[model samples]
Target chain A: MGGDFGPQVTVPASVQALLQYPELKVILFGDQSAITSQLSLLNQLQHPRLSIVHCEHVIANETRPSQALRSSQGTSMRMALDSVSDGQADACVSAGNTGALMALSRYTLKQLPGVDRPALVTAIPTNTDNKTWLLDLGANVSCDADTLFQFAVMGAVLAEQENSASPRVALLNIGEEEIKGNDLVKRCAEMLANSPDINYIGYLEGNELYSGRADVIVCDGFVGNVSLKTSEGVANLFIDSIKNAISTNPLKRLVAKWLFNDLFISLKQLNPDQYNGASLLGLRGIVVKSHGSADVAAFSNAIGEAVHEVKRQIPTKISDRLEEVLLERHY
Target chain B: MGGDFGPQVTVPASVQALLQYPELKVILFGDQSAITSQLSLLNQLQHPRLSIVHCEHVIANETRPSQALRSSQGTSMRMALDSVSDGQADACVSAGNTGALMALSRYTLKQLPGVDRPALVTAIPTNTDNKTWLLDLGANVSCDADTLFQFAVMGAVLAEQENSASPRVALLNIGEEEIKGNDLVKRCAEMLANSPDINYIGYLEGNELYSGRADVIVCDGFVGNVSLKTSEGVANLFIDSIKNAISTNPLKRLVAKWLFNDLFISLKQLNPDQYNGASLLGLRGIVVKSHGSADVAAFSNAIGEAVHEVKRQIPTKISDRLEEVLLERHY
Candidate 1:
């Protein structure tokens, strides 16, 4: 009843997740008939550790955030978030409408203290073996100096956990000079440089995102989202262009049979679907937003990310770091 | 002296440009002896149309904009710009420091009235036969709604002149919806929609930049620079990864010879060098900034672009449009 393919993909992905994690339990919240039909098709209707809470209302993709919050109490997306808030579930994952999902999760769990709005952070693969975590994917379009500073702190905490070390952070800017960015970015850079709690690498240009100059790159949601989407667009153009070129003639097509073998293996390594889940940071509970167009394998990866976040206690760690910074300021 | 290769590339490139346009005359601005030696090597030293201006001062890449404006009067970069300002040359092209060039040009010629600062706009090849022009490459970091609207008008004029038709202008944002961007971007969109001169298509996402949906895309310099640089980084990464994969095996390497034939052709067509010159729009005189690491061919393309701008009378047309816009507002 949600996402592009709804239970068709999520149900199979859940079964796959259950296979991977033996101790896992799943409570699906969607139309009973839709869930039953799929479960019965796979003969998983009587599977142990799986339950369905019949939910009639579905949050459509076109539903506005305000409308969803006003009348989506019984919606699957809302119930899933509520399950996490009420301690019935350890974490929640959804491929529903992003705006509605964010609104409902914030409305249900409320933002953590000292956080105005949660930012979306996702891992983008770089030329280096590791990936860079970019925050505010499309959360807050325009941010003040303080809000940007807060994103740095939150992003640093997440990157530390994600990288299993103290992450080197840099403000995303046009140039690497102290005078390159606007006043807001310059102010944020100065504050981060003076702070002693994190590794604050001054400024990183967009060309440096995949050049592996920083572990965490922070910017306002508008720039972050545009950069991320533009990267994807170029990548698609590259691959599609190659495919069309290979298909242009029989000789190239013959070569593509083997050429595509290793080409795809490398391409698969950089697939956006392989890194589908984006964490809604600064929220009180864990909520992972899977790309709406994600398929079974991609949705499975999102579920895995949710499981990993729950185990890592990422929110708790961020809370502690925030408190430490706040108490230091008070002192 | 400023770019990576400097006169070694520039001198040969100037010779190549002169060969293409026989009526073209060049004034070499740098050390007289170095220019003489390079010209002799190409048998271009005594060419009647080629003249050498002995200028010992060279602008270093590391020079700050303020320092360049205050003390770089005698430097080659500044002299080249002066030639254009005095109407001795049709236009100026340089592979020098971008910040310094922008500063020196603005200070020497003065900005057009009603223009705060000029923006860096470059043509990017798209899937379609035509190219898209993205502005504020790394010039102004933060722009108000009025500034953004100005970019649209400037970009629209440039695109119309470049494409010989009214170009579709768009505001680059995270989403295509009207509610997608910040307050500033939203307000700018509204003004563009109401404007009757250009074809305003409203909001466009970053993914659509290379999709050839719009002819001119506008954004704050920070986002524009990042998007441009990020696209370059990804394109490089895509090619490099495929090269590594193909080189891993002998069979793949053999196929790559023939396999890479059309692939390289398509890539070369999309090469940034082929579209090298970035126009510094909103200035009284025409100036083009070439990539610092550009080769002889790329530098030649930049020079060609400058000549084209001079012939097209782009700056005069933009000035007229600005006056028209101002008069409309006055009424």
Candidate 2:
């Protein structure tokens, strides 16, 4: 009972995930009636791998994170987190309010031993086949140099998991020069440069973000969030402009039937649905947050991401790596 | 002597502007020989409105802003700005390094009264016919609440000149709420809301940037620069993906010959060239900064923007409006 669509979208997505992964088991936490109605509609009311926990309350998207934290008992988001905390579930996925989810996850799951704060990390589609892992995507609005250094480690760990190698880490700054950004960014850059264990590739400008120059790009949440959202906005504008171009011309419309099908095939790499889930890293338990407005395919992608993290033991890897890095620095 | 193409791009652009505006006089401040060669190629070397001032130095793009200011006496960028300050020219336009240009502009033409620092403001192409004015695009790395509030006023002033109305000014943040954003942003939002002189909208997310929701959007330079560049990156990615799609199908290419022309015709409003110039506002004189990689048409657009600002007396307007608004609040 989260996100804009509530059970209508999540139920089908859960069913899809169950079908995709033979060993996957899903626990749906929401109002039993709403969950059952959708389950019955899809004839999955009694699926063997699927279970339902009747949740009494749901968190509204408008609720303040601070307020949500105090009164989160029995809420679907909290109960789901509790299930993870109690070791019943390997990971939890939600499409609820971002701030509330972050707050609840941080409070309930707690931070890893060497981690200062949990960061929201997501893979952004690049111009090439490879995806760039961008971190601190609205998890913390502002971060100090130490926190940013920690984020770089976490981001590189995630990228290493995906790429199966020493990932190239780059600091997101206004300019590539050593003297370009604010003191906070400069200090963070210095820390990354001094770290021998990390493959720090110096600074990257925002324009080169999708150039596939770095495996992991790190920045504070404010800049990362704005950059991520701004990319989406530009993509939307381009799509709208193209669609308008196709619609306005009658001849183009006739050609678009064949052309658009091929175009979508080529443009599939740039689709947002495939990159739906943004995992909250640095926490003890895995929590993958889906977009609030995710559709069925998008929500299914989030579930897949949680499944991937569970198998990879991402939280454990992050904890071990952070400890190793901190120990190497004699911290 | 500035930008990628230097006189190769600027000379033709100056000739175009002189042709477009008969009253406009252009002083070319660079190597006199290089300026004459380009002017002679265009056969505008002896044009009545065209003149050249030989400059002894050029600032490399890699030069730090601090170092650029120290030796900027006879540099092309500085000379052009000095012309504006000495009343030889009403406005200055450059496609030099952004940091160098900002430092020189601030040093040569002092800030307006009541303005803490100058901000870079530019019009972004929107989904509708109207454009959005975004400010503080890499002028200052970070800004306080008072500086952001002043940016809002300056941005609105520029937007009003374009729209001829009370432009709706919105603060760019991760979310739209009283509680959202960092302390500085929240405090600035309060300032905008409290001021009766500003038509302040609540807040704008990055995804709504091109939706034309607000005429003027304000943010600190760091966030603003990243957002602006991120949008460009996304646009480039989209164009590349579409071009790749078009190239893969030979039959589609034949259809694209006609369809592409029509498509470009419809997509003209979204073109970057028309919106190339980013003005440095809240200064004692008008200074327009062109894209460093700008072509002739794009450079001409920057000159056109400078001409418009000169005619409107944008700096004077900003100073007067800022004083009036500041006086009203007893600041």
Candidate 3:
């Protein structure tokens, strides 16, 4: 994983991965000694499935992804992506710089057919039986009507695979009303409504998403990023607030104990790390982007998700669906 | 107070005002009987301060404030704002259309000097000891460098008045590094860093807002709106998740009871309603905009806040500060 604090966290994570999945093979892509030092601390050592691919060069936290990738050929993050592109690995995962990861993947691997831009897609648990999938969480800031429509298509496909059944897609607007958003959302609504490939359920306000309105929500990168981050901040805020309320006064603490189950379920649903990495949709290969602050458990979960995506052949399914949509478009 | 749903929520809220502050005067601007009926339900009969102006007209939800005011004269929200402008009331509060409120307020009340656009400022409770004031939360979608700089100044002033002494203002960027954001954020950073009006603390990444980086966080409307909503969504998600987790198995629920105080405090810290209603800064009068879903408690708290703003003469203070900043700009 491409993280700021490298193998310090990844080493324990790799060991945890082995424990979770017996058949899993983990190839560490960082400084050899750093990886070795971390792995040596683990109780289980010298597992055949665990291997290290050392790329001595490191991408400093301050370095821009584009500049780093252009200047350093041996950066661990770049090498990991290269391994995926060159078929040395089935998929790649990272918890390092998000912008750098996006820039590197877009520049190196390139976009898939009919995919104008690759979006960061994550599954958010909803009140419904199935979770909701949201896209363009932080990949592209500016987007047009057509791009959003494409996001709906991609998000729907991802949701179908992840949550089962045909996922209903909705455009994330300021309001549920078609006429209630800025110019971008209005045009996007029109385009998504016209598109036949998506199971478009029309527009949903930001607040309605948590109310379990739809299975897939699509928006431009700016809005999606804010929504995703806002959700994280609010979740953290809620957890913090609850803790303070219950602990600050003695009486409330007793009440809190009785309502503990109710509160825990609520707080856990909002942790971004629990959901882990978002899938880089509309890419030729299955790539997952984890949060920069992701710990060992989060990274391992991302890897597990990556494995699931690869096994599911999500890319192939998306390609086939896009081709069908394109054929229908010509008609 | 510019919200999607007004009168229905506001009328009841106005009645609840009496309970919170017994000496408060409430002049209902909508149809006299409509508001009276709501007040009557609370068993408040013939209170000297509770009065209503007969106005049958309303600004439609879709109508822009400029258009609504030009075309319609008797809108309840418009009349309420007129009460503030004409000095009929100490402050104006609304849960009606936000765009309409902004448009009407800007047109009727006018902006303070050196203020290009009046921002919607609100205080969200963070994990830190002090609450953070975020401005331009949803006022203007697109803003220039100058506009953003003004927002920072006004946000800081608001933060200070809200009890944050020597408030530190931070420009909201994608990353915390000096060079790590889009062109707009970069330009804003330079302006904020150079500005004498605000206690500029440099940049804050989206994820770090909750981590207590700064007291006042400033951004354009698009980013601010998304961030605010996303925070709300995430809060809800966390509450739901924690509830599910605690109840997932009987054993976890038992443990959850013991940790209830910690959990509840954290969740309460993120309650959006507690921070409901953003002030329209840079305006002639104190205009507070509460959320459409604001409950009786939120409404009561908003009324309390309006009283505080009126007592502090926030508008005059902001005006004086703006003059000081502008004069410094000339020198």
Candidate 4:
């Protein structure tokens, strides 16, 4: 049962992430009578950290990520990526079908050793005291220069696990001129300007991807999904041209409902449902994904980004910092 | 001579496009004593439809478009592309060095015979009912699929001269899938889905490039200059985060100046200085470019888009509809 309000928005966003994580556990995987009739209209259907597991096949938001990674095996998005590849789920969230949740989360949890393919990462909201991250947001729609130097070292170790001591890094490029792009973004900005243990920074255009001057940008998943869906289509054409210019002046809709309730309370601090999840970075366990038109508060912020990448064991910290920066560039 | 407000914003934007075109005539071409000392500080220093032409070999916004078309021969952006290739200028606006004005306007007015290289177009504002041309906004940075089927027949003959009766066209693709991109955008969306003489409209994503539903759009030139500088860096981060959340409340900046005055008058109708010029399309004379940090009313709307593509002759309607669609595809 993939997105577009699937179990009426993933069963009340998995019973509100099992009532905000008191050691959360949800195992839903799909259509056991349409997720138990949306978890029997949610009075937390007998909720001892919830459970469902019935999944009799579903996956089609027009399937085809190489034919749903070889025929979506018993699909509730491949049994929620086979319950996080069988070790009884540390993390798995979907909203589903972003190319069948990135080809069944890279064919049921694979890729982590000094990672070669898994990239899609996200997070952009910027003015800065943290939030830039980007990556191969569409997952390898033609990358190179060593998979954009391993998507700038897994977007600088996921922005240095947000504690951010020295993040920066860049390379989305179309001019910050080392003779601007092509020839594979000038050989991925000459391998992030000769690595030097990666605080790189040489280039970043597409209008400085939310100008929080780089805490890992990188590109190549079709220019990071066209610079993250052209900044969500210019913030949905500036909130539909300010609600069609305040519904054409019935005294500017009574002063635009106190100016769109003080601009949607500071645009709910740049909310795409409070930045719903994306991760799928160099994979080997955690899956995240979300936005297949996510709702119920953006699939409970993609189950609070798979419980913050399973309490920060973000795939053993990107497989121990991509095996110590690929054995110190012995690549 | 070339942007960053050269001659204090192109000599008061060529004296406000010769006071809004009474058959306008300009010709200043740089350093005629820093443009007659900025038209002797704009007291209209002898402005009989203006003329200056002093040119002292300049071109240096970090040169190299093959060394600025071989030593920027007689500079002022090469005598304004040799005064539109000797027809003494019907069109040629510049904000300098867009790869040295597409290599001296393709080494002086060349291409346009079933054109090969020269796309960098513009015009984006779109909630439709106009605006959305796009193109190789950075000029040929790795294109192929027959240069994106000749940028979808020169962006559907410049969106059918912006009247757009049958324009729709498309291609930009990072997924509005027909097997989403790469493989040169699926062999240029199978030559605009078997051509029927252009109105293509298949793949579109990058959030439907301002969801004003495709009136041409095309791609390449590094994903059309990262989808036109990521929609000018998401309209400069939504006008610097709604002016830092309406300046942290002194009664919310006196109720955010009457609710940001009808959302900045419908965001000044999606202004980037009212879409300041760009059009370098399949050459044969008509240049445009602007915005190297444009400012005198956005270089008088890039000299009113080079007097609206020299009064819409637009290189005799794109060399007679690209020589009747390249002789009805006999290429």
Candidate 5:
């Protein structure tokens, strides 16, 4: 059992994923009875492509990483990651605690060679009808310059998989000037600029995030997390403003009811459901973390992302590319 | 002399402020000829309440803080701040380089007693029709726990001047849990919890920023700046999305042209011009930094903010309150 709705949402989402991808096999690592009950409701209890492994413990959303790591022997999150590490599963997806997920994934699956830390990477929608990759989203709260540089390397390798030969890597800073940012960001900039493998852009401020100026934006976990969350907050405020505008008058409300459907269709690119999954990058095994409050459709999107990553062999490519870049730079 | 349009924007803004506030007097520091030319255009060249102090040097926006500090003897930004220090002006407002302004203000006006560093504080509009104060917006990139605690103290004091005796102060972080954030934020949280003067409300994530759950949010300049700019980016993206939606079809364009005015009026609170001023808090004298690209209306708003801070005697109140709190906590 995991996430807010546990098996009720996860089982349905997994069933949807199984229906969508004919060759995809899913292994549910949670309470067998709970999974069976939900699968039974969907008439998928004995689906040929689906299996279940009963987990004795479940990680709470509030559990600290350290606490979860200590008693994570038979937990659902631990067993799922174990399936990937043991070569039984191609990838693992979970709508559970992010901190515990990262901690357990690091402990069970381990980091890729030359990767000091695993960063949480996600695709953020931009105004240019494309997405930019943002990394270190609360994986490591504080990162040294060397750690940040490694994140840029991993981020660039990940972005290159999206069809760009050499992704423009940028350090997320307060200003675009050469003299802006602290010692950590400045040093990281220097490292990225000198690396021949990375197409290092000088700096990108937060306002330029949605301009699609860079393919990969890297920063310490704290700044990345705040920027992502702040975007959500502003989006919510804007949506609320629209709702209030339509509700204040009867005529406007009627007009909105007539035209809102088309408006939403036009703005479909801004949908959060499509961007639900965040991959734990730099790990040896693929682990996709879904939003805790995700619904069936959103969780299904997370499963789709994991399948995509597995098909692309993201982890292997990141490992090989990082090694080549490091060996060349003598880093 | 300073900012993008220099005296062209600031002069007309000064005239506007003189018109709005009959008892107010404005001292403009820039090229005398440029200031007079703009005032002459508005037919206020002989205005008694307005005076101009010509400065030979000007600081470019690209200048670093350290570089600006070295050669800022007779620059427009430095002279404006010096007027406040010498009691020639009650407060100062500039639409110039943020870093240079911060350095020169700290050098001329100096920090209030018990204050380690002055912070850039601004009012962000929330959905509740009230604004929340956010501080350390790119003032100090990397802050220790003690410095962050001082920002909270100064933030609370500033918020109190806005008619709230006990403003709920919150530390901005990635998560709302006690175990979240870096060591600096954690240590600052502990200090805030034990202090009797502050109304500490624990951690606040970025998504909760606009929910009005906290009246004042404190963080290091790096995170605060990123959050603020990210919000602006999101807002711009949403606006662009709406524009794209309306322009995609002829019928929608016609409808938008008819109703967009009313919709914009309803969303007037989201306008950036009204929130153009960001005060440099914890300083002995009031110094409001306007957006560099601000027009006349936006620059006038900055002057209005300075007058409000002067009337409230924010600096003296902040200095006194911080001393009382520090003394009570034996800090």
Candidate 6:
């Protein structure tokens, strides 16, 4: 979560995590004064597990992640990931900058064997009891047949770890037809249909993904990012639209008050914060990327997700499965 | 509006249009029996201005629009555009296939001067008093800087025709900053920022398009399509989530009933049918494309839009402006 706002959000979230789970340990990494000030605001002066790693300077807006990482050896996010890579920290979570996080994690941890491009995987609540996992939401925009196939395998393994025993995978396409969508979707479908490592359920339209037809959906980063943002925009638009409509008229206002709680709960369930962090699948170590705008609740959820990924050893299992599938396909 | 599920949706909508406005005239272009059968289902069938143009066949699903135009001579959609080109009809509306509509219109009507690609412009209802116009939602996915500039001009012209005077146009990008987005958006910003033809207000993020920041929002078909679909998906998800949350408990159910009208009105405002048809901007004649799943309301709206476009002489005005701009740009 290489976040733009930095320690302000992360520090409070760290304290909240400790309050929720007594055993939970959090390390605050950022500008020392900024982290201490945020924690002080929360009345968390000091704790056994909570500690701060001081980094006087910060990455500027114009500095690329590689440039920042190479120049600043002890940046907050970098140090956190380094902890994970060196076995000091089980997993690392950030709600900062996405590109920075991806670059740092990939460079430091290295890509998993047989995985060409790592994908950003996030869960979206669906109509069904089970949540649907969408991948490459903004990781790799352009993907080949092999990259897409590997994404499906990795996504399936991640879903299984999340709870699904045999998660069904579907390629995001314009239409359900085997021949529909751009060249990439078409090629990916052909590969997924033949791949034996994952339970590929065939093609799914953008609309059907939320309709709860499949558990795991995969696409190139360009389409995925657009889809994800589109979803978020629509959700915000609806809520705002409803709120405006309700406040407009007297009769509607009365109705709105009665139905407010129901709507609130329903909207809460769909909140991006509830499904806040995206796992950087195909990385050697567990790296959960939270949204830059994530609040305390969202950050806590992301930290919990990071903890789960480490405890389950999901990366190792996914890598082993990916290698077997790649070898079989190659031979 | 050449749609796969034509005649059934369009015929009723055509009748509804006539019923809504007694002065309106409708000419259905499709299989005669299919049109007649639908008309027979309506109570007031006999009208002096209502007529039909018989076409024997339609473009099949597998046929690309360009391929269909080259091979299928008697397709209904192509024939409808021919009616406009030949002055038999003032404008054409279809709930038929989109690709076929694009291909036939581009071939028959040709492009307005200076317009490289004819964009599909759709209106989305926002919280503000005016509806937001989103262009090239699914017309041309891959476009260059020049094409985007043309799209902005066409979109702005269409918006003005639709009663938006001095319609502000904004290039949709990943971020609002001029430097944000990919190469296409960046170059488009430079062109749009300096272009005398458009009232360019700079870049708008995908999320802020609904905030009423700009009247006309422009993007390539790929991004536009995803944005439109994503908005639809999120809106649907929000409604579903709210409904589920409300019904989960009795207390919430009471609140939901009170807020039902507010929610319904707001959701209805966001409904695609309200802003159903997308004008194929830059075409020689007025051509409106409705969604394939368009019901009676959407089709009727498309017909209404066609009538409005014809009355406003949008195509002619856009062509005149584009010609002027093209000459100035030395294109």
Docking class of 4: incorrect
Off by over 4 Å in 5: A176-179, A266-268, A271-274, B176-179, B266-268, B271-274
- TM-score winner: 2
lDDT of each: 0.83, 0.88, 0.75, 0.78, 0.86, 0.77
List residue ranges in candidate 2 displaced over 4 A: A176-179, A271-274, B176-179, B265-274
Q: What would the DockQ be for model 2?
A: 0.61
Expressed as tens digits, the lDDT of each residue in A1-331 for candidate 4 is 6877788888887787777778888888877887887787776678888888887788777777888777887888788788788888887888777876877788788888867788888787776677888888777888778878887887787788783866888877776242377888777777667777788877788877877888888888887887678777777888788778677768767766754676666565554335778888888898888888877877887888788778878788778876787677786
Model 2, C-alpha of A305: deviation from truth (Å):
0.3
Model 1, A96: alpha-carbon shift in Å?
1.2
Tell me each candidate's i-RMS in Å. 1.8, 2.2, 4.6, 10.3, 2.2, 3.8
**What are the models' TM-scores?**
0.97, 0.98, 0.86, 0.37, 0.96, 0.89
Question: Candidate 6 chain B: worst 10 consecutive residues by lDDT?
Answer: B173-182
Give the candidates in order of TM-score, highest first: 2, 1, 5, 6, 3, 4
**DockQ category of candidate 2:** medium
Docking level for model 3: acceptable
lDDT of 2: 0.88
Write down the TM-score for model 1. Answer: 0.97
Clashing residue pairs in candidate 2 are none
Number of the candidate with higher TM-score, 2 or 4: 2
What ranking of all candidate models by DockQ puts the best one first?
A: 1, 2, 5, 6, 3, 4
TM-score of chain A of 3: 0.93
Single-chain TM-score of chain A, each candidate = 0.96, 0.97, 0.93, 0.36, 0.96, 0.93
What is candidate 6's local distance difference test score?
0.77
Best by DockQ, which number?
1
- Candidate with the larger lDDT of 3 and 6: 6
Model 3 off-target regions past 4 Å? A1-5, A15-24, A37-46, A176-179, A245-266, A323-331, B1-24, B36-46, B60-67, B176-179, B210-212, B238-269
Q: Order the candidates by lDDT, highest first — what do you get?
A: 2, 5, 1, 4, 6, 3
